[model samples]
Target: MSATQSYAHSRQQKLVVGFSQTPAPTTGLTRQEIRDLSLKGVKTRAASTAGSGRLHGKVAIITGAGPELAIGTGAARLFAREGAKHIYLLDYNPAPLSRLAEALREKYPNTKASPNPMRHSRSTVDQDGVLDLAVSALVDQAIQEEGHLDVFFANAGIIQRPPKRVGGGGDEIAEELRATGRNMGGIEDTEFMEVLRVNTLRWVEAGSNISYAFKSPIHARPWRAETLGIFGLSVFLGIKYASAAMAKTTSNKTKSVPGGSIILTASVAGLKANAGPIPYSASKAAVISLAQTTAYELAGSNIRVNAICPGLIETDMTRGAFEMARMAGKEGRMGVLNPLLRQGLGVEVAQMALFLASDDSSYVNGQALPVDGGLTASMPYIRPKL
Candidate 1:
């Protein structure tokens, strides 16, 4: 057996595998930064995330597609743009889900709709058989109308707290840990368990080879990669167990939809941290890296996979920043703190998400693409004399 050399120093080792280019791109800088001094003052849109129409006319099920678009809705809309006829939009919060569904209904009148059986009424992770039963129900619903589940957006996740400030000065260590506990473990046991159920475990159980999960940070600093493993290894292991269970399922309904795909949602915190809890940053970093490992392990079944690393898009997770900055104008804060000097809209990240979910990204596997408007790439001067 050939010994595998450590990738500790190679540029390739630092890169997320299967992306068109290594390390993806930061927020403001294009994949190619020509650095035109004359054009520095002008704004230029990068090539469309909707490149080449990958998800056209395919069916997709997007979980937690709340109006606020915590993660998956952006991609769902892009899926519609990609020609998806049936969109199964699901979410726990009825108000936003209904509103977003209404918007989508207006956008894609021709597309069939079955709004996820109304959560918790046999649709929530809280219900014991709900996850498995709902999985079959949703897939069956699609198969019944659309013939088969063509594209699956396993983007169901929750980041519950209203949002809190983290990463204070040297005097704030204790407060940071306290804040992290809330992020790591919810105030209510049921809520916390529910977080793990939806945010971490369900995609594995649902035959979704890919998933995206994120949360509000309790700290604003990066953690050693191992810390993330401790938090998320259970979910990765859960995926293993879930895959085994699916192998033994009495039915193999999804046998015709080609193969499985998973895109675990992570954040800039994972790779680069501006300010947040250690657990949140560490776990997110783990989410992305573990996805790399999982991509390697689960490759036998034609299951392509990847990750979506988003920065301060409008969501419950980053409300605190909004509170600190104030107004829609505060999108600048997302960029201000970030090297990119601009925050990203949910739709921006969503498009990239749809690509990974659809066959358009067939060659793309096990990568982490950042949608933070260049947040991670820019670092602030700390030492005053570096």
Candidate 2:
């Protein structure tokens, strides 16, 4: 069978194993016929179905790239599966980062995955150092490849720890403590400042990455698991303005404004209080606030800004800690917020992220959404007696 016929029969759902269709004459086909054929699920012989090319003409970037970099790995794969022309997987560390890019190449095929230019990488916890560099690098990548930046998924942060108690409004205190001069220079300052630097600032700069993408895939477990992505998760930052700006930037899809989207990953712990470090909670809360505010501010930019608040997402950062907690018999505590009564899946969250990144959400914006399933709002279905 010819490639065109093979793809067509499959696209028409006529065959389960193949999908190739003949192009109805290049310039002679009627618009309605083209639409009908497409609706009927016809594909040109040269179509890539795995990625489906949702991001076919767009660009994107993911940062921090710790083992959780797998989240980006999965998203890159999905973006390719959806047909993103240029999916940039960036990180500071080379080994794991390179591995992530290579792994993506294996799964996605033909997508360019590489270490982001050092000039744009925020290597240290202090984000301001490479803020402009990182932002410009992403912008440059998009312009050089597609002549425009479409979406920015700013997903990276630092200074994470076990949940802390909200004694006398601890989240407020954490935010207050983080605001101290310690961020740049504080006497006997704690790590909150550094956490503030990475989570908040880096997340903000990523919004500025302006490559293209969103929050759903990053926060949902089902999406993450199926797609092997974690794009759907809460971002770490306390600034609502950044998110709002992002929303505005991407939403202004006018003839003059460039089109794009922004997805901020926040934690569910922000929606609820926890007993760990105050800054972590506050940091997440800031991320949530940014999602809401960014949606409002950037609505005019044709840029959609949204926040994804996650709960107990087990990444390398938290896996060991959770396991340690498990070894110490903190199962009850660890399992407190999961709606299905289990740890959430990163890939599931990544799927929500992919939705936010694609054209599917062209009309959605300025929202602080949650993918915690019923967990964020669900009361414990089963009260376990210890």
Candidate 3:
């Protein structure tokens, strides 16, 4: 059988296996409840299904690859299973990054996985004297070592949530978040300069003033390149650096045209309002725009740029919400608002990333694809029983 047919068969087998493992929900539940139960029925599947080696011999970089439930970590494991040459994992925390790298090595010995911790010190230069070069530095390293870069999944991002505390007002919580200055913009003097620096970039003005702005590795750096090029957030920096690296003609593929896949992790919140906080929504909207504009800008470069906007996925970023629901005994109703009626697993998002990263999406470019369980496809309406 052809490779395509074999893959289809493998997928079918996996689907059958997944269904067999999950029994049908009991009747008498509402339509939405039934749908939710059906979705949640299937346990979290392994990252690799058929191990068809779709990414064989390709070098890929994935940021935000730390937590066990993070989207980047899942993609890293999946990419490695698919026979990637090497996977560079980056995250702000060193411990988790190291752990993930070690795990990948043990599972996929053939694939080289390196953990590069991107420390977010409040300065241009950190202890290692590396100039806050999160994505750019990594891109350069990959090119030097591999002679070419293939897939770059900019999956690093954060969402600021007000801490739950007794006797703390909204203003107090906001102030507390500002004091942390985790991403940028402090409480007083430091905050003003951070705001100015962020605004001077102009492209990310909306997020500059947000003290507790959602951030990623790319957002930690004020400027991506030495010449002060492409001023924006995490995914923006990823597009700028990754695209540049991908466009270069390396020694290994000197005669061939430069080509690669750049996948940005946006959010369904970016597609519409009432989905996320004001700052987060605005930042994600910018991410979607970047994917669109950059695809056109690099039209003939053979580098396909796309954004995957996930919805209600149970990743490290959204673990709190899931935990709250479970604590309230409403875990089963976590994602009932969506047509799918259940929260999506990180592996599900990884599957979408795999599609975009592989040659399967060679012709697909400059698009913002939603992987949100059909959440954005419909408006606010109750599901009626047949």
RMSD to the true structure for each prediction, in A, is 12.3, 18.5, 11.6
- How much is the lDDT of residue 253 in candidate 2? 40
Q: What is the alpha-carbon lDDT for the whole of candidate 2? A: 0.51
lDDT of 1 at 203: 23
- Candidate 2 ranges beyond 4 A from true positions: 1-50, 66-70, 116-130, 159-189, 202-257, 325-336, 379-386
lDDT of 2 by residue, 43-112 (tens): 2321334456677756665544435424544455566676666665544556666666666668766666
Model 1 C-alpha lDDT per residue in residues 66-149, reported as the tens digit of each score? 656366667666676666767776555666666666676786676655344644322222112225455545555555555545
Name the regions of candidate 3 deviating beyond 4 angstroms: 1-44, 117-132, 161-230, 253-255, 381-386
Please provide TM-scores, in order, for all candidate models, with all chains considered together. 0.60, 0.60, 0.72
C-alpha lDDT values of all predictions: 0.51, 0.51, 0.67
Residue 110 displacement (Å), model 2: 2.8
Candidate 3 — worst ten consecutive residues by lDDT sum?
121-130
* Residue 136, model 2, lDDT: 45
Q: Of the pair 1 and 3, which is ahead by TM-score?
A: 3
Higher-lDDT candidate among 1 and 2?
1
